[model samples]
Target: MKEFIDYLLKFGDLNEQQISCITANAVETELRKDAYFAEAGKVVRQTGFMTEGILRNYYYNSKGEEITKYFVEENNVVICKASFDNEIPATSYLQAVTDCRLIIFPKKNWEEISGTVMIWDSLMQKIISRALVRKVERISPLVSQDATTRYLEFLEHYPGLANRVPLSYIASYLGITQQSLSRIRKNIR
Candidate 1:
């Protein structure tokens, strides 16, 4: 809860009443490693503020292979806005790569809060805009970079995650085979 408040405060000021309103609808959940916060074909009904651990968003490609799309770590918010906005099922899944603690706001209440609280909508916009920009930045690398370069870029961007995340997931994230990631690791060493 503190983490959520602190993160939002970075984007905009929140008074006690506004904080109370938002917190009133927020719920805390814990997931063991490998648990999923959301799954494909289900509607994503909440926006989560990750307080602890990491999550990966993914989709199965046309070949039925899981392709990792993005990572959400502590202090990050995870939502499938396309689904959330349209009130439809999600096309991807959000799974915990590590045990996680999350403070989440229900989508229905979030809508109301934006109207009730000053700057809530602005804070949300700032948060979502930042997330969109980050999404674009992460996606842009995959098409332009080779596997080894992608791995290096991943390390450059998320240095601490390399050891914590499984090599298989990292390989998927880099759009490379596990054997390829192993070779890259060997070359780096």
Candidate 2:
């Protein structure tokens, strides 16, 4: 819980009162590997603060294959924002790739806490900004770079993702075929 609070503080300068409110209604849970934190077609009830382990956010393609969208590592927030915000069914899935230690807080609780805690509002803004920046980055090189170059850039940004996630998932995220990804890796090596 201290670690989760520390992470929140890193996003903004938070006072003790705000920190107290943030931690007040939170609950900690241990998620085993392969657990579904948030699933497609289900409304997200809680947003998680990952103290440890890896999580993947993905969506299904028309063919029903799961295509990885993003990976959240330790000290990151894991949520399906659209589902959480609107209380609607999710289009994406959130899953634990490793056994995880997480702090979970319901959206209702977060709203109540943030309503009183000004720092929490700032924290949410910062998080949104970061997500936007990452979206820009992911799309930019796809327009300007070759597939091999894009693959290299992906490695640069997510150093261990290729090794951590399955090859098919990584390939789908790269917008390339698994065979192409393998070729790119060979060329890079």
User: Residues 15-101, candidate 2, lDDT per residue (tens digit)?
Assistant: 887778888878899899999999898999898788988888888888988777778877778777888989999988888888889
Candidate 1 Cα misplacement greater than 4 A, ranges: none
Best by lDDT: 1
- Evaluate model 2: give its TM-score: 0.89
Q: lDDT value for candidate 1?
A: 0.89
lDDT of each residue in 72-165, candidate 1, tens digit only: 9998988888888888989999999999999887888878787789788788889999999988887799899988888898998776999999
TM-score of model number 1: 0.95
Each model's lDDT: 0.89, 0.83
Clashes per model (N, Cα, C within 3 A): 0, 0
